[model samples]
Target: MSWDDPRPMSPHLQVYKLPITAKLSILHRGTGGALFLGLILMIAVLVSAASGPESWASMHSFLSGFFGQLIIFGFTFALYYHACNGVRHLFWDIGKGLDLENARKSGIAVLIASVVLTLLTWLIAAIV
Candidate 1:
């Protein structure tokens, strides 16, 4: 009646390798949580704008600082990454891109699209 069985356990994490899609899946969840936290910051910015010009300016100054810009950049990247991955998930829902090779290509495409879109958005913002 021992709980332990004679079956051998699977290899530990050290011996296992994760595929690109698996890595992206982990990143997708992490970015989702980051976006949730970023929403709080966005709300604070909006509230400051509603308070007064001085409050809005103070918030703007903080957002324009190096640390704030870095955080915003991270949030931007996360937003884009989550969006692209979401489209991929939608494809999965529609019974598409289910093959192993197709899944890998789609995962890579999502990553590239997210980075490209994030850079394109920032570039346009800087230009305007």
Candidate 2:
């Protein structure tokens, strides 16, 4: 290859058909990342609280906004989905639900339960 040479990029979604298993596997990883980030944010809040009231107050004040509320809501959903799906993975590790049909069913169940739990949390949070 010369300095001025151009190369073709690898094929992406445009040339690939994403399978259900592959998509779900990738989504599991992405949601896991989101959950880890949410935990880090929680740790930051804890550190602020432990440092001093002024720090705590600043953190609390920032979270009182619409964008903060939106982030909180997204975090809650990510936490719920990751937790529910984690348990599902655990069940598979214990020699259960390894069948392809059952695996698909369990994945569907996790999605439904996560949405319900997240919605309930939001409803309660709003009421309070």
User: What TM-score against the true fold does each predicted structure earn?
Assistant: 0.88, 0.77
Against the true structure, candidate 1 reaches a TM-score of: 0.88
What is the model-wide C-alpha lDDT for candidate 1?
0.95
Candidate 2 TM-score, true structure as reference? 0.77
Per-model tally of clashing residue pairs: 0, 0
lDDT top scorer: 1
Candidate 2 residues lying further than 4 Å off, grouped into runs, are 1-12
Deviation (Å) of 112 in candidate 1: 0.2
Cα error of candidate 1 at position 86, Å: 0.9
Score candidate 2 by lDDT: 0.85
Please, what are the lDDT tens digits per residue for candidate 1 over residues 1-128?
A: 45698877788779889889889999999999999989999999999999999999999999999999989999999999999999999999999999999999999999999999999989999999
Best by TM-score: 1
In model 1, the Cα lDDT at residue 105 comes to 98
